[model samples]
Target: MKKVKHGGNIYEIAEKLGIQKEEIIDFSANINPLGVPINFKKALIENIDRIENYPDPEYNGLIQAIAKEHHINREYITVGNGATEVIFSMIASLKPKKSMILAPTFGEYERALMRAGSQVEYFHLKEENDFQVDDDILKTIDESFDLVILCNPNNPTSQMVENKRLIKILKHCEKNHVHLMMDEAFIDFVDEPTKETMLPYIMNYHNLIIVKALTKFYALPGLRIGYGITSNVRLLERVNDHKEPWTINSYAAMAGMVFKDKIYREKSREWITSERKDFFDELKKINKIKVYKPNGNYILFKLLEERKDLREVLLKKKILIRSCSNYKNLDESFYRIAIKDKGLNKLFAKALKEVLYES
Candidate 1:
């Protein structure tokens, strides 16, 4: 098990740069620019005393919020401290001998799969194809693998797997006796989550599992609440049985209440829907980099010409963007940045141009 570097490392970057954390404009983390929901903030203030009690090991309230939001049975939901916790618990319980993942998708999947002693294989998404998972994925999955994990609107690429193609792959995995796990953590920020999600198929396929996170869209990364949904009763039970009790803190448990806060949710949806297009179009005009069309709340770009270490240059300007060098299939020319407020997006664009032409 080799240790791998993870992104959104503003603290480390700030320490090395000798600057205050607040001074950096972090476009590294794909978090909502709206910041934490106002409803969650008020709840935290009013119930600050919640810190005294241990969070319910059962997490009934959290599960109910998720279930009601998705219009699914409460029994199908399993909450975790964050999506990462659920990911680790599920992979550990399944104990698959062989697992498959996307080469440049979120890194944690490989880490979790490897920790469970599974032989990992990658469906190397091609750069020429703009990193989309194509029909070939169905042909690649077979009986040899016991588990397959995919990140829709995949990280570092921000490219979505079409619903039709995803269903075909799901059917392929199901017939092959391979468990399919879809990480829809960023799905809420996608164009049409209702149409794209695999949640609707869970009831029909016991082999299907969907993981979601409140950390990204809800801007509650600090609160650390995430969950996995599956109709596979046996595997769900195994996940619960192996999970550490109280992994979700009291604040995290209450943070789930904000999910149903319609006002905040709508505002977030409107912001992402309207701003992402303009931002993507603007990035396209920059000659210094090649921007990948985004389907999520982040855009992936590659530097052109001689400026390979652009991330280091931007850090000097107190802007933190994710350098994709550590990702399995990415290198120095690549980086990923969050789609933020219009003003911040402009700030990033200006800073990037300045770094390119003036630095």
Candidate 2:
């Protein structure tokens, strides 16, 4: 299996441009602009010696933290190196023979499904509809599919499924005995995260599984900690049976500590609530590209004219944005950029205008 490429690779872009990675402004990865939490950093430094010992094989403390955060039972939770491990492990345990996913959604789902020997199908989201999920998906899913994956506030597009419609899908999947895995990696950044999350549906629907990452919201992508929640004990046991031990490092296991950082959480919500609207409105003013309204911490836009190489041009100015051409439903004209700090976002907007109009 050749590896899949993801955003946030400032190192490679910097190397190619003959500059330090920090010199490049990266809008490629959808991460919290506030950076890692200060309290967590201090804790990490104070307890650096924990690395000398192996992480708890079951990651008890981490699971407890996640449970407390969601007000769920520890029995329903499972941890992994990142969201990908939980996803792959879930698929491996379920061993689905067939699965369905959104066409332009996260790429890792398809890879994991394939690795588990499942035939894959796509629910192609149309660009004309602003890439939103609708009732049409109900017709596409049936007993034929053993699993269905959804990325809430989907990557690249940054559009979320409406709650009523999302529940309908979950219920439909339940009726068909299909496992519905909702990836809530970006849900924390959504305007109404509590209302939009599938976390609440887990206890009532054993078939529903929710996976989340501390990577984006906590700005700890490098730490590699993520988890999954479901009410199905058998499924959790299966995931544990076949999983490798100590997948999370000692530092990553301390992820549970960050959940109680309410100050950081409030500040992050403030940033998204402010930045998302401002960034979307600013991009809308640029007639050269069509910007999609964003619920997550990123914006997806399409170049209006013939400038398919917009990504390349922006790189010359030491700016890196995600090229979404690799996504199934998207084309070369499509791109996704992260919502950074106010100053950096303004600088990006200026650089973009210069490339499109002046240059």
Candidate 3:
């Protein structure tokens, strides 16, 4: 399998351009424009001495916080360096013989499946359907597959699997004895996450597993804090036992504090709700591209014009957007951009308009 290219690599772009990293306005990685929360910053500063010792292997406080936030049992929660670790470890433990994933979704699922020696298949999301998961997925998933993966409000595309339709798929997978892994990393940014989340279904279906990250929503990507939730205690134990010790550092363990920052949480909600609307609305005016309505903090668009070198052109202007060419089902014409604060988003819009039309 080939290596998957992820966004947020300002270092490489900076090096190639011989410019400082700070000069680049990145819309490549879908992170919070509000940046790190003030409370978390204070916690990090106060807990700087935490590095002096190893993190509690059990991560009691962290697990408790997460459990409280979701009202799930701590026994069902498993923490990792990031959702990536929990994903790899969970797949490894499951050791599924055959697995299925959505094409043009996050790349790590295939990579992790390959590492576990599972044969991978893709359920291609039709471009004409706005790349949304529909009833067809229920037919695609059956007893033949050992595991099925879904990225709710899927990456790049930023489209969600409707709750009603998702339940139908879940029932089908359950009846077929197929394990379903749902990565809800960006769900927090969506409107009405409570209505859409599958966290409530985990208890009823042992086969259901949810992988989430505090990285994007909490602006703690560098801290590498993520976790998996499932009612399958046995599977959780296996995942914990098979994994390396203390993959989560002391500082990362402090992620539990983020959940308690209600003030910061509300502020973040206000920012994403407002900015996502304004930014997406502005992008819609640019006729050079077809913008997909977004539920996450990022938007995916396709260049209607013939230009395939948009990323390069924008980079010259100190702007960076994710080229979707490397994603399984997407081509060079497709690109994904993070919804940022008003000024930067406007700047990106201007740069993109110039690249698409003026140039």
What's each prediction's TM-score? 0.98, 0.99, 0.99
Residue-level lDDT of model 1, residues 1-359, one tens digit each, is 78767667778888998888889899999999898888779889999898888878898888888888899988888999899999999999999999999989999999898899999999998999999898988888899999999998799799999999989999999999999999999999999999999999999999999999999998888888899999998999999989878988888888668876889889999999988998998889999889999999999999987754888888878888888988988888899999999999999998888888885
- Per-residue CA lDDT of model 3 for 1-359, tens digit only, reads 78789999999999999999999999999999788888889888998899889999999989999999999889999999999999999999999999999988999999999999999999999899999988888878889899999999899899999999988888999999999999999999999989999998989999999999999998888989899999999999999999899999998887888888888889889989998899888889999899999999999999998865899989989999999999999999999999888899888888888877886
lDDT of 2 by residue, 226-249 (tens): 999999999999999999899999
Candidate 2, residue 252: how far the Cα is off, in Å: 0.7
Runs in model 3 deviating more than 4 A are none
Shift in Å, residue 326, candidate 3? 0.6
Q: Between which residue pairs do clashes occur in model 2? A: none
Q: What is the lDDT of residue 202 in candidate 2?
A: 89
- What lDDT would candidate 1 get against the real structure? 0.90
